[model samples]
Target: MEVTPLINYINRIVTLTPEEEIILSEYVVYRQYLKDQYILQQGDVCKHANFIVKGCAKTFHADNNGQEHIIMFSVEDWWASDMGSFITQTPADYNVQCIENTELIQFNHETIEELYAKIPKLERCFRQITERALVSSLKRIVRNFSKTAKERYIIFKENYPEIEQRIPQYMLASYLGISKEFLSKIKSQLAKETKS
Candidate 1:
């Protein structure tokens, strides 16, 4: 399979040599998951850094009441990992579950470190990615703290319209801090307003 987007995404920050690309391709494993399958689970150490090729996955926490609160959704070309756990080699407190049938490219930490040695530019690309992810995480926290459910839903729709279309309503509700019923009402309201 061609990995043009992965290459292009990396190339945006750093150009890799042919040999570096060869190393990357050799170490990277492609995987597919059906909806609701777990890519990672709480208490498991994240072994691979996953890059989405297509579809969506969410990282979430389950409470004692058996309710899941979604922290983030990773879509096509997005990178996903429990960053603290991945970097610290500690147990993860969240799960990464597929929202749709998905394809991903995963590389082990060690393999990635090897790539860093071979292609310093790759480190720069990954560093930038980490910075972006951090900013997104901070923004999510701010939204949770300051925005009402409807406002959060509106922002999510504006920012990730494609992801909104792909994921189920219940999951989106979980992510938006609203009950499914509330989200349905919001959806109906938005639809009615749009029709006018």
Candidate 2:
């Protein structure tokens, strides 16, 4: 029932009245998930939009060969959901799994609709959130095509310094679209360059 973090996150994008805050608290359901737990799985309809109050999660798609291609990572104060599925209420193409013990404030389709009806500002806040996510995804796609592996690795480290220490190296490598060995080499090369 802790909702301060959720309230604070929303306030950053749009100011909410005290009454609206209370309404939001009522609409959201707080949930905890253990590490490696799947909040969502491929082929299942995403029932809720989850806001991370704490911990980390990875959103990825499993290929036919069963290899997971990471789409993104979410940590404290971030949001995690299969947007396509959540909005459309269709089968999800990606899986959202917790990388650490996670606390989330979730809003289901009905509750969110009701909340939006009750507080019109919330709809605008969510729209902005979705737009930002879309922009970030587009940027990642551009980087993957235009940048070298080492360049992408450096950018990842720069953007997600907190995430680097939390997840395994292999997962990080997967996110960078490179092999673990290659990432190690890049790190070693960078280390040598820094030492010289």
Candidate 3:
């Protein structure tokens, strides 16, 4: 698969000279996964930082009751990984699963380290990306604690318009920390309001 999307994302943060781009490209590996496939399972070390080139995936963890809670969804041009595990080289508490047949460009830890050594600007690029992701996660946590289910649902739809259509209603409910029935009611209310 062409790595234009990944390269484009990098260029947005820091300009990459042709030689630098070539060096970065040397470390990228392309992979395809079928829908429902587990890219990173709970207890397994997350070996790569995956960028979705096509399709969607989710990061989630199951509770002792075997109930799963979604942490986030990643669509085309977005990333999905257990960052803690990827960085620490330890087992992950969450799972990253493909929601559709997905194509990804992945960079393994060793390759990333090599890129950092060979192209230091690339290190800054990734650092910025990770920092942004961390901030987004913190904001979501705060919103989940403070926002009502309806409000959270609306915000989720607004933030993930592309993802909203591709995932199942129950999965969306899980992401919003609400029940499927409640989500259905929320949608009905929104539909009526839209019609009036």
Candidate 4:
């Protein structure tokens, strides 16, 4: 399997020599899922931290009424996991599903621990990844509380223009915590503004 994305992502956080990359390869597993296939499900333990190689996935939770509330989206070169579940070896509160045919490289808890032991520098790299994920989560929570729906939609579009092209409008609406009709209106207004 192609590993350029994973290599480049790691290189961004920490330098990796050829030997170090070989060590990392030992712990990484590749998987492919079709669109709509689940990488994880609510109440199931999340065993791996998944790095997207070629597609997209979303993390979401279903309420008691069975309505899904999207938590986040991960596209190519991004990572996603219920880190709490992966680290604690407990059931996940959220589900991660492929939004398109996807290729991913994943490292399970045991493999990660082994990697850390074998490659001390990896611990620092992984820590940075965790920290960034936490900061992004906090930012999203703050934005949800403070921003208007239209403002949030605008931010989403700016951050994930390619994602908007790939995902269904209804899914995008769910991610933005708005109804499909409202998202439609917002898109129409933005389109008109751009045309003028």
Candidate 5:
């Protein structure tokens, strides 16, 4: 896979000189996960940070009752990993699973550290990414706290127009913190409003 998006994302974060880009590219490894595979199982250290090239994946946690709640979804051009596991090299409490067969550009934690040492500008790039990720997570927390289920659904659709159709309703319900039946009811209400 051509990792153009990952390169572009890095370039946006820091103007990577040609030599820097080449050095960074040397560390990237391309991998594919089949549908339904767990890219990062709960309790395993997430050693690699993945940049999505194709397909969809989700980060989720399972409750005591064995129910899963999705924390995040990643599609093309997005990155997904267990934050705690990647940083600490500790076992993660969450799982990252491929919803569809996925192609990803992956770089090991060691490789990232090497990049930081060799190209310090790349460290600035990751720092910016971390800040943005934190901000986005906070915004999602606020949205979950303040928005109604229907409203959250609308917002989700607005924000991820491309992935909305590809994602399953049950998974969407988990992400929205609503029951699947509730999501069905909301869809029916939307249909009723449309017919009138």
Candidate 6:
């Protein structure tokens, strides 16, 4: 499988020599999953850090009432894993499921550790990626508390216009922490305002 996308992504964060790139590629594994397949299921240890080559996935948690609350959505060029579980080798609280047929480049814990030892710069690259993900998560939390549902919807649309078309309305609503009906109302209101 081609790993150019993963290599390019890593290169953007940290320059890698050709030999280092070859080593990195050798350490990673490629896998594909069909739509609705689970990449990381709740209560299972997340064994690999997955980098999307193509496709969409959502990480979410199901509550006692059996409602799924989406934590995040990832697409091509994005990394999808339960970070805590992957790092700690513990059972995951969230499930990462494919929204569409997906292709991924994965690094198991041991392989990643060996890569870090062989190509020390990889540690820096992954650290930056982790920090960015953490910042994005924090920002989303702040937005959830501070922004109105309509405002959140507008932001979501602006940031992920492509994703909006791919996912179901109910799933989008779940991501925005609102009801499907409320999202429809918000859309209608926005449309009426746009026309006036």
lDDT of 1 by residue, 40-76 (tens): 9988999889999987899999988988999899998
Taken over the whole model, the C-alpha lDDT of each candidate is: 0.86, 0.95, 0.92, 0.91, 0.90, 0.95
lDDT, model 1? 0.86
Candidate 3 TM-score versus the reference: 0.97
TM-score (all chains, Cα) for each model: 0.92, 0.98, 0.97, 0.96, 0.95, 0.98
lDDT of 2 by residue, 3-98 (tens): 999999999999999999998899999999999999999999999999999999999999999999998899999989999999999999999999
Relative to the true structure, candidate 6 reaches a TM of 0.98
Clashing pairs in 4: none
lDDT of 2 at 194: 93
In candidate 6, what are the lDDT values of residues 46-106, reduced to their tens digit?
9999999999999999998999999889999999999999999999999999999999999
Of 5 and 6, the candidate ranking higher by TM-score: 6
Off-target runs (Cα >4 Å) in candidate 6 are none
User: What is the C-alpha lDDT profile of model 4 across 1-196, one tens digit per residue?
Assistant: 6677898899998999999888888789999999999999999999899999999999999999999899889999888788889989999999999999999999988778788998899899989988999999899999999999989999998988888888888888999999999999998999999999
Residue 86's C-alpha lDDT in candidate 1?
88
Candidate 1: Cα lDDT at 57: 92
Candidate 5: misplaced stretches above 4 Å?
A: none
The TM-score measured for candidate 2 stands at 0.98
